[model samples]
Target chain A: MALRVGVVGGGQLARMMIAPAVELGVELRVLAEAEGMAASAAATAVGDYRDAETVVAFARDVDVLTFDHEHVPQEVLAALVDAGIPVRPGPGPLRFAQDKLAMRARLAELGMPQPDWAAVAGADDLGAFLAAHGGRAVVKTPRGGYDGKGVRVVRDPDDAADWFEAAQGAPLLVEELVDFSRELAQQVARRPSGQMRAYPVVETVQRDGVCAEVIAPAPHGGDRLSAVAASIGTAIAEGLDVTGMLAVEMFETTDERLLVNELAMRPHNSGHWSQEGAVTSQFEQHLRAVLDLPLGTAEPVAPWTVMVNILGGPEVGDIDGRFAGVMSEHPSAKIHTYGKASRPGRKVGHVNVSGFDLDDVAYEARAAASHFD
Target chain B: MALRVGVVGGGQLARMMIAPAVELGVELRVLAEAEGMAASAAATAVGDYRDAETVVAFARDVDVLTFDHEHVPQEVLAALVDAGIPVRPGPGPLRFAQDKLAMRARLAELGMPQPDWAAVAGADDLGAFLAAHGGRAVVKTPRGGYDGKGVRVVRDPDDAADWFEAAQGAPLLVEELVDFSRELAQQVARRPSGQMRAYPVVETVQRDGVCAEVIAPAPHGGDRLSAVAASIGTAIAEGLDVTGMLAVEMFETTDERLLVNELAMRPHNSGHWSQEGAVTSQFEQHLRAVLDLPLGTAEPVAPWTVMVNILGGPEVGDIDGRFAGVMSEHPSAKIHTYGKASRPGRKVGHVNVSGFDLDDVAYEARAAASHFD
Candidate 1:
């Protein structure tokens, strides 16, 4: 009786899980989007995840079904659950991550701190909400928005008219633009049996709304911020009955209060620093939690850890060719690549550096990551 | 072009190399002994290492050829080199690891410290050597012996008569049984370009000639021992012209002098602790050295780290069932399984624990490993 774990997506998140899966003696089978995808390193079945028949066939062989992303359709997820296959985070909680308006309303009901937001049906509704809150607002589509797509900053209601037309009557959300000092991410894991653990909050630097780097134990983020972040993570895990990994993306406002901004029901890019910094990586923890196994410690192993993502640049050559120079310059930096080809703005890999000195670790991580570019 | 590395064995060593190979962006292809071997996680070709044509064909696509074990028959290795395939630790040096007689002769010529030894052909030769030295001696077949096999301790020459008959005139070595307090292993990686790095000497515990545990920065091991071990490792790397990972298993006598015992020309069991304990893992270092890439730092990440091997026991069920309790109890202990099936006394996996305190780390590592047993 092999303990088989099936992952729904074969992106980098799923690819990174291969190392821990091999170490744990667990059989992992991934439903990759296509051949040569990031996670093709493991046992893979390339098929459309949107097809219920294909996804259900993949789930039939696994003890538990989980995901690399929260993009699976709700109806398809329901079929798996109805068939008695265990799906972590279930469809009920994953809907929040799928739809922005639903997440805002749920957080409000749960009495969680968030930016003032409202669901707008059209341009007229957006204009009213903008007048009531502030002149400027962030407008977003409820579904399919990620990494700056399906999102826009609006000074006037007309700016969102195109989105309303594209939505075809689906509700959209407009919220007051948050003036945050810095962005932080809190990662937490939960088992269906109620066991839970939270990692140290990390500060993330973004370029063009994409994560560029992450610093563990966020700089100047004292006990107050940590406590607030942990509380938020724990509440989300319990409130949503989420099993497996949960990432709470937060905004530390200029006034010093933390506001929840986004939610990811799987391993997030911001927690990539933990792969070298923490005793147990989030990818490993996710497997344990989803399998109802005891959770691992989320404690930091180093004083400071910095992770910089290697976004594809103009240089077109084999990545291994650059290893000699970069490795010679920064021998302690740990590099991880997704086995992906170079394409501008794509996250091809990341570098992690952990040490006693924060500045040194940060510099090494950034320098090593930039080498690929 | 991608940097392709071809390994000539499909054991756990090659399996473990897959992780680091993926991280380093090197496309690793292994010539496995059979289908479904441990290293099948990577691109693999099932072939016999003894067959020169199969091995050479396998090496055709690789930029550099290496080995997961020294058992790849010297002639086949020579053929690979003759074909202009870059083989790290070229057959000239790999001969030392393949034959004890050659290793001992070379070490003696290099003026290295070792037990008084002789190449014995028969009972008569054994008797003369035993009489000249102490009555008690250790006898071993020069080639194809591992994990206590083909080795015996004897006070009478008659004790080695059976081995002599089995050898049928193949060479054998007999050495005076050195009185040693504990065994220490120093692991070093060398590149063809003359770059080298040494890891801290670790105290190894052996059970029936198999490595059972390793404690890094050896307990109560002073600076004098560390310097001596590092020097021995450096000398061997330069003296043997060995390229890639070299493990020197030595005897730390009660009198505080070191005697060379065994040599491994690739990643060794004693270096397994480096996966969690050191800044650069021996597997990754081996890849770098073999590829002639710049080596990484071999510094220890923690003050103390303990590694305990997981020997398969009689428990006949899924190994994953035990992981829940063991991981819950010792969340920080890192477990590395070879994706092997359970069999009594087999080297199935290992556990590593690193922290500030030696006693605590040792306890956690042993306890977690015991669960599998």
Candidate 2:
């Protein structure tokens, strides 16, 4: 019998996993949120992730369970564990990604470089954190936040009055606004047997808190910075006993120091560049890690690999028709489109261009992606 | 709606297409021969390819129809065309791949390089051809032969008595065995609009007439021979009006001449290295060409890429257990399993390794594949 992997989330992450699973001779079954989710292309069971009954039933047949997103409730995860299902990035480590407050506390305990943070229960607590942190702070709800949602920057506690009300007494996380020069993302994969591998640190450009483009190997990234990023990624994966992919988003301070910004226990948008850039893609690496197989090499095939995301514009239209023109314009560009309905400001696809020349690859990637707009 | 592709066979060629299909956002529906064929991972319709109704029904839901192999009867293919369904490498071109006699005749008509050949009906005819051609010839059934089946080298007319009896007067293709130094394969993709691209010619090693390993950019292959191979591919694709991928298997004579051996109208074993070696994979290129989308670049990513097939040995056990050790030992090796049940001498999977040194890449690929044995 083939190894059956159950992924809980029907987004592009799971959709991408389908290819690797097929190549590995593993059967992939996805628990999607809806009928037409991106992962509907695979063997999927549609249901709400929060329902323990639905989740447990979905996990019944698979030999192991992993996730495409960190949104599954701990209660449902715990139930699967109780049923003796092998869940990668088990509930223990997934907790750190589920709650911002928990992640901050853990990073602080590990003596990792991070901005000053505090858990705030109300406006008074928020005021105190702001006053202590240069009169401004980044406030975020501890749970259910993603893609720039459930997050706010405030100069005064009064500016977060709506968030405080919406939290309904739940503790919110507040951190000092990071004064960084640029953003970098490091991806690492770990097997249950403790095997680990880290990809080259890449500079990620964000627009409205969403990843816009990624330049792999981070141009101008000295050996020291790359080493520091690699060490940090390795530390987090080992410390958390992560059994799959872990993405550490960091801020490279002007002082040449790195600060942890956020943690994702699953494949992140930043690692998408590895699809064509590296010998083994993050999607394939995640499957290897989850199945307790040795990790594949993370070596970049080219000197530079540039990735540009295709965001859905304000207009509603099909992206399929643009394939001919984009391919004709840049024959070497690798395009990966998610089978999703285009919505305003949504991520629908990405373009990857790899070559020896960084500037040429970056320009091609960006230019090809812009046409899809 | 996405462009739907319906493939006639459920073999590994169609199975490998699942990966590129996901990235292209193209829906692939395969008419598998059985319930658990390799391509069951996709949207499959289990039915007989010989049944015109079943094939037409499967074609109804797809935008274009293609084949994993050329075994589909000519009548069934004609039915699809008569029904207004687009079939890549349309019936006219596919006929060449289906019958050796037809292919040899067509190549001769085009003034292409080929060995001396003749069509024999029985022992008397075979004796005449053998006597005329050094008293030795390679005899083969004209239709429905693959791998090393239904082909034999005979020195006497009575040597193929059993085959002649079984054939019952059916014509057999007879040809003089050419003295060759090595075998080479060139793959090319063409779209309905006439756009074409050819991949680098590669040297192929055969074991019992089955492709065992392939080395891209055939070693010692000078620019002249490479140019000749490319032109031959282009000519065949254009002259035959073949759409999608066409693989031309050729023999390089000891005197340094290229002669046509066989033709395959879909992604063939010789092009498997393109998955990691080239900017665009044959599987992806085939989809784009068949869909009438502009084809992607066929540029090689690495200087040398070696591919070794993993044939099932004399063992009934699963090869999955060996994956961990193989991956750990060769972290850079790319493995592709077909998800088929293991049977002695069956082709279950393949391994690909790419690097600057041809010898090193070839060794690694062979070493990793042997572990599965």
Candidate 3:
């Protein structure tokens, strides 16, 4: 029988996995939230992931269960585990990704480098955190937060008064504002058998808190930086017991120190460049990992690879309308779309370009992506 | 609406197209001959491709029609075109692929070099050809033949007596067997607008008339040979007014001449290496060509890429049973499996490896494929 993998959530991540699953001859079934989602092609069950019965039913026929996002409630995950469903990045590890407060606390226990953080229950607690961090801090909701949502910068406790009230005594996460030169992301894949592979660290360019571009191996990263990033990524995957793909977003300080900024227990935007740049793409690796197959090599196929996302897509028409123009001008650029409608700030698609010259690859990727604007 | 492509057969070629179609956000629908075919994941219609009514119904929702193999009947194709559906590699060009005798005659008319051949009506005609060509020749049924079927080498005219009796006065195709040192295949993609891109010619190793291995760019092929191969491929595609992908199988004789041997008007086994080796895979290029979109570059991603077919899978179990061992042993080899039952001589999967060293790539690909045996 072909290995069957059940994925919860039908976002672009789930859509991207369909390609590798088809190539690997694995049967992938998605539990999309609704019809017409990006991953509708593979979605077999449509229901809320929060309902234990719905998730348990979705996992019945699959050999293992994984995620498109880390938002499946712990209660629903517990039910699946009780039913003997093998969930990669089990609830124990997923809690950290779903809640920033838990992730910070766990990283502290693991001795990973990260900014100072506190769980603030009220204005008094928030005031203390702000005052201790140059009177500036980042406040966040511990649950259901993604992209730039549920996050805010605060100079005064009043900046997050609404969040404090909404928390209703549940502590909100607040962290010291990080002063960094740039952002970087390190990706690692780990099989249930404990085998692991790390991709090179990539420099990410974000606009309005959304990833705009990424450069594989991070130009000028040097041996030490690459090694450090990989080591940190490996350490996190092991420490968190991440069984599928893990992405660690970090801040490169002015002093060259790497501090954890965020964690994704699934394929992240930073590694999208690997689709054409690396020997084994993250999507393929994730499938292998979830199925407990031996991990593949994560070596880069070229010296450089650049990825630029097509945010919002074309204003007046679908992304498909721009294919002729973009494809004509950039023959080597690999364009990937999510089958989603255009909405301002939405990640509709991306273009990846790989070659020996970093400048040319980056320019080509950006130019090809610009057509969707 | 996404660009919908209707493939007329449910085979491995159509199965491989699923990956690129999903990645490109193009909708691919296949008309399978039966339920649970290799391309069942995308098989939206299960019907006979030879039936004009069945094929025309399948083409109703798609923007353009193409093939997984060159076996669709001309009447079915004519029906689709008559209904205003776009059929790539239209009936005019597909007849050459459907009938070897027609292809030979057309190539001869175009002044292309090929083995000395003739349409023999009886034993007398066959005897004369054999007597003039070292008392040996090859006879083919000219239709419904693939992978050694319907073809035979003959030293005596009576060796094909049964075939001649079955022909019922219809001429059989007979050719002088050319003593060749190696076999090669060239692939070219042309859009409906006439723009074309040619991939590097590759060397193919055939076992029992079935493709066993392929080496991209044909190691030891000088610039002259590559140019000649590309030119021939381009000429065949343009001369036939073929749209989409075209594969031209050729023989490199001991005296240094490239002679056309066979023609395939869809993604062929010879170009499978391009799935990982080239900047644009033939399946993706075929889709773009049929849609009349600008074609992507066909440059090789590495110095060499070797592909080895996995025939008949395992003796006891399915191909999935061997994945762990093969993956652990050859982490860099890309394994692609077609969801099909194991049968002797049946192509169940393939392995692709690409690198700077041709020897290493070939060794890795062969080693990985051997695990299936």
i-RMSD per candidate, Å: 1.3, 0.7, 0.6
Predicted structure with the largest TM-score when compared to the true one: 3
Clashing pairs in 1: none
TM-score of 1: 0.98
Q: What is the C-alpha lDDT of each candidate?
A: 0.89, 0.91, 0.93
Winner on lDDT (1 vs 3): 3
Maximum-lDDT candidate: 3
Q: How many backbone clashes does candidate 2 have?
A: 0
Candidate numbers sorted by lDDT from highest down: 3, 2, 1
Q: Can you list each candidate's DockQ?
A: 0.69, 0.90, 0.87
Native contact fraction (fnat) of model 1: 0.62
> Residue by residue across A249-302, what tens digits does model 2's lDDT show?
999988889999999998889999999899999999999999898999998999
Question: Clashes in model 2: which pairs?
Answer: none
TM-score of each model, paired residue for residue:
0.98, 0.98, 0.99
Candidate 3's residue-wise lDDT over A107-223, tens digit each? 999999998999989999999888888999999999888888888999999999898888888999999999999999999999988999999999999999899999998988899
Residue A224 in model 2: lDDT: 89
